[model samples]
Every structure is written in structure tokens, then in C-alpha cells.
Target: MKEKLIQRYSASERINHWIVAVCFVLLAVSGLAFFYPAFFWLTGIFGTPQLARILHPFIGVVMFLGFFIQFFRYWHHNILNREDVKWMKSVKEVLKGNEVGDIGRYNGGQKGMFWVMTLCLLALIGSGIIAWRPYFAIHFPIPVIRIALLVHSASAVALIASIIVHVYAALWVKGTIRAMVEGVVTHAWAKKHHPKWYREMTSKK
Candidate 1:
């Protein structure tokens, strides 16, 4: 039997998502190496430690730009609504292999993570500029630079944690990863996980 499929993301959207994902992994590995002595070996990801230091900020800029484009593309769908509130309140049930409310393109957890990523990216770029030596850092005072470095580190940790959760959630939910990777999902998958989105898409067809 031929399984029905629905387009969840276009080729361009999937490409952009992957670009950001790759940049994020590179940044996380290098950033951790730079931030902690124990994980300094991770610098090998970008060649030598010196190379990692040089490439970290540049990769960060790319990730920021990539996610910035994604933000504008999907932010509207991620906006919280009454259904999202219901989903959030029943998160425990959601964890027990059940979905809640009339989910659209994203559930409450996905919506929350979207905003968290946005805020973390904003903090990272802003503080990173202030702490980027021999460039914008030179204009800032020593104490201010120290604070920026602190903020940058904290935000990086938060972003890393959030991404970990994001990855886990994607893996935990059946067919979730396929949506991003293949840019399509089975009709059953869509209808089960995002009923409202399924309806919207089907209505258009």
C-alpha cells in the first residue's frame, strides 16, 4: 500500500535548518573547549585551539544569521495561544505518550523552545560582540568586558541545554526528525501530532 505523505517543510527551509544545526554543533564544541580546560581537547573539532578561537565567533555569526531567517519564517506559528496554554498545563500527559489540545504547527513545548532560542541567540551575539577582542572589545571598558563574557558564557550554557532538550524531543517523538530531514511526514503522523496543522494543510489540497 502507498502511504500518504504531506509536505511539512520545503527544500529551502530544510536546507536553512540544517545550516543552523551544523553551525550550532560546531559552535557548541568549540565554545565548550574555550570555556573549560577539561574539554580543551574538543578544540580539535576546528583544528588547533588557536583555530577554534578564531572560527568560533565567525561560526556564531553564521548561526545567528541562519536562525534569524528561521525566526521570521516560523515565529508566527510558534506564537502561544489558548491551546498552547492547555498543552503546557498538561505537559505530564504529553510526556506519557499523549498529545494535548489542538496543536497546530508546533506544540507548547516547541513554542517555548523557539522563544528561548531567540532570546539566547540575542544575548549571545550582543555579549559576544562586547567580548570579541581586537575588534569591538577594545572599545569597551575592562569591567564591562568581563560582564559581557559572563553573560555570553551563561547564555551559551542555556542555549546548549535547550538544544539538548530539542534534540531529545525530536528523537522521542516518532516521525518528528523525519519532518525536518525529509521535509515531509506521513499523513497519519501529522494528523496524530498536529491535528490543526494537518487540517489546515489538507484543507488547502
Candidate 2:
């Protein structure tokens, strides 16, 4: 028997999600403005190239901190389990649009994505601190600063790609956007997508 679930995300979670999302958009636009001449026009969106350069790191800091909040909240649920390994083995089926029976709370893909984002956040933050100019960079060695720049740019590119995939997955799955926006998922939607999670949430301890 299917039954509705209570709130899966609180108001704080939604707020944090949006904060990270907005920061991501800002950083993406500004970062791209400097990445290529074609995207140089993007700086106009923020004001000027000088201003975009000034704002990118600050925006990245805010986005990463927001991600940290979400990371702590969901970390426990994202731990890998035997079920996740099994789900990984059947990933091809999942891509083919077949629902692997007994899909767990997050499945392997979501778990992998969570860890990927977490690692990327750490890399971005660490390298960002090293490369930040007119401040910390003055104290750091030139070689260290150069390496930090490389790592920061590489991590940013990888993070952006991961987020694109994440967004695509959210949109690909029907009812997913509503879950993030409204903090609720219908019982049927939950069961069909994450049977193990649905059962666990609804079951008596």
C-alpha cells in the first residue's frame, strides 16, 4: 500500500540550495567571461572584466560554503552500501530506462555524484585560497601560486560539468524538480524511483 511521505527537505535546505544555485550561475558566467574571447562578452552581464575577476572568487566562496551545508546534511544518507555496488553493476540498465529492482535511497550514480561534488568543492576551496590575489597570494611562493591557479581552473571546469550532469538528471526524472522546489515527493513517485528509500521512510522501526 502506497502512502505519502512527510517533508523531505526543510525551508533551510531549500534556501541553501538556491543560494548555491545562484552563486553557481554567477561564477559560471564570470569565469567563462575570462576563459575565452567569445565569452568575453559575458563580463558585460556583471559589469566589466575587472569587476568579473573581482567577483568570481567571492562568489565561489559563497557557493562552496553553501555546498558544505548540504554536504553535511546529506552525507550520512550518501554513504556507499552493498546495494549501491549492485546498482552500479546494473547501471547500463538504468541508462536504458529500466528501473533496477530494489534501487536504494540514492543508488550508485547519486552516491558517486555526491562524492564527486564534495571532492571538487574541497579542491576548489583549497586552490582558491592559494590563488586569491591582492591578499593571500602575496605571502605564498610563486610556484605554489602557479600550481594553485592550475588546480583551481581545472577543478572549476570539472565542477561545472558535474553540475550540468546533475541538472540534466534532475530534469530527466519526472517529479524531481518539484521535490527540490517544494520539498515533497508523491508516494508513487518515491516508490517507483527509490523503492528502498520509500519502504524505509514509511516502515516502523
In model 2, how large is the Cα lDDT of residue 109? 86
lDDT against the true structure, each candidate: 0.95, 0.86
- What RMSD does each model have against the real structure? 0.7, 2.2
Score residue 93 of candidate 1 by CA lDDT.
94
RMSD of 2: 2.2
Question: For residues 1-205, what per-residue lDDT tens digits would candidate 2 score against the true structure?
Answer: 6756545677889999999999988988887788779989999877878888888889888998899999999999899887788878988888887777676667788889999999988998899888889878898999999899789889889989999999999999888888889998888777888898888888844
Q: Where does candidate 2 stray beyond 4 Å?
A: 1-6
lDDT of 1 by residue, 1-205 (tens): 9989999899999999999999999999999998899999999998899998898999999999999999999999998999999999999999998889999999999999999999999999999999997789999999999999999999999999999999999999999899999998999999888999999999997
